[model samples]
Target: MNPAKVALVTALAGGLSIGAALLGERWIDPEGGGIPLAGLGQGEPVQWPEIRLPDLAGHEHSSDTWSGHPLILNFWAAWCPPCLEELPRLERFAQRHADAGIRVVAIAVDRPEATRAFLAAHPVDLTILLAELETITLTRRLGNRVEGLPFTVAFDARGRHVFSHLGALEQDQFEQLAARLDAPSATPR
Candidate 1:
């Protein structure tokens, strides 16, 4: 085979590979934004699953521990960089909204030991919960289609899920979510 022919074939293969990847991304995230794959549950009455996960101290707590308040449930892992990046912002939001009855809970989809170590070095004001192997299923039920890190879901005081984001919640996004927190809770069906 000629050298020029081989180069052309290799280049074509590389271009095709890149094109496929971009198309797949577009399909998964049609908006080309941080939003997760849509249609799971938004502006709907999603009953929070009944699972008792543990805190850093190993005390089991129900998912409804913060019921009757606006809640932000963030699914994360210590090994995930984006998850770590959003912690400070979430902590600040939690502290700022403490008096408003808004709760920010971070459910760590990692080992208890890993979560404890990470929290010790980088303390946060947000309530941290430990999840085990059921993390993926739990997050999926809560609108995490890609099962990715830093997934956030917001529930109104009535425990209705109002908003969900797949990626790190940036400042602007958080502002939008904060507004949703103030929205009147859905009337019970």
Candidate 2:
């Protein structure tokens, strides 16, 4: 075989191999970094879907309006045991961090009657929202599916999802996530 021909064949083979590798990386799991949030390390920004709801007192509210501030969204029904306990803690957390640009949005997924009665007795201090049919639409739209109550989705200032927890959360879990929220830009997300 001619030297020039062998060289050309080798270069072409290398280029084709490179192309195949790149294609595989793009279509398959790229670099194996897309694992769940099991680790405390920062994660990809969760772009939550637009959601709307009413307050306990019956007022139209849109999730988009809460952009620019970090949002703590808690999915709960008035009757959920863990939620009852979490409301007070969430309220306190909201009050403690209000000046820090954190906005706690509690979304109650239950009948308006039940929610009203629950709120009258419990009186949550955080901004509580009612999940109407509109809420159902929005909830389904979110990147995270709503399997049940007590689902918490935390969003950054840009409405990106920082983390989500299914089931009741103790104060420390949120505290760690808050620390991540306050991290400097140089830190890896």
Candidate 3:
């Protein structure tokens, strides 16, 4: 083989190998944000990790506060439009389900002032928890691969994670969640 041809072939092979490696990396980590995927499963019993954050009123809270009861854990941000759009419906859901021992909790991943402002104007009747970057970590722990806004996680009366949604919860989804949590034997959805 000619010397120039041999060098060209080797360069091409190396380039292709590098390209394949880059493609594989993207497939494994789509967002390139370096969050390891938990691959959380539906119906799989999961323990909620202990997280401490302040509320709009500047009261500190731990995740365990919502334990021992059915909970709707929503991870949202003030900048997310979908998150904002779903707040009213979630508030209504919380109000309707509050008597049934279901606690709706919203964990906001934004500055306290922004969250307070948004809540002050919108007025959601649910527990709000403020977090910084840990909000994304919490969402990932709950099986949100994309860490998208409006992520919701549901826990049964026993405090086992039963359902998780990564996008805005539709009305039907909220109703179905209510039914599942209200049932004695809540199955994974």
Clash number for model 3?
A: 0
For TM-score, candidate 1 versus 2, the one ahead is: 1
What TM-score would every model get versus the actual structure? 0.75, 0.69, 0.73
Best by TM-score: 1
Comparing 1 and 2 on lDDT, the stronger one: 1
Q: Each prediction's Cα RMSD?
A: 9.3, 18.1, 13.2
User: Mind giving the per-residue lDDT tens digits that candidate 1 earns over 1-189?
Assistant: 669747854664465456445534532446554333335634555865677888888888886787778888888888777889998988888887788888888999877888899999999877888887887788778766556677788777777766777667776667666766776653232
Candidates 2 and 3 compared by TM-score, better number? 3
Candidate 2 worst ten-residue window by lDDT: 33-42
lDDT of 3: 0.72
The residue pairs that clash in candidate 1, if any, are none
On a 0 to 1 TM-score scale, where does candidate 3 land against the true structure?
0.73
Per-residue accuracy of model 2 over 1-189 as CA lDDT, tens digit each: 669746854664465456445533332223443312412224654475576677866787887787777777887777666778777777877887788777788888877888888888877678888776666455434422334446677777766666665456777666765676665641224
Worst 10 residues of 3 by lDDT: 27-36
Q: Which digits, one per residue and each the tens of the lDDT, describe model 3 over residues 1-78?
A: 569746854664465456445533432334543322234546645876677888887888887887778877888877
Report the error of model 1 at residue 4, Å.
40
Q: List the candidate 2 regions with Cα displacement exceeding 4 Å.
A: 1-45, 134-137, 140-146, 186-189
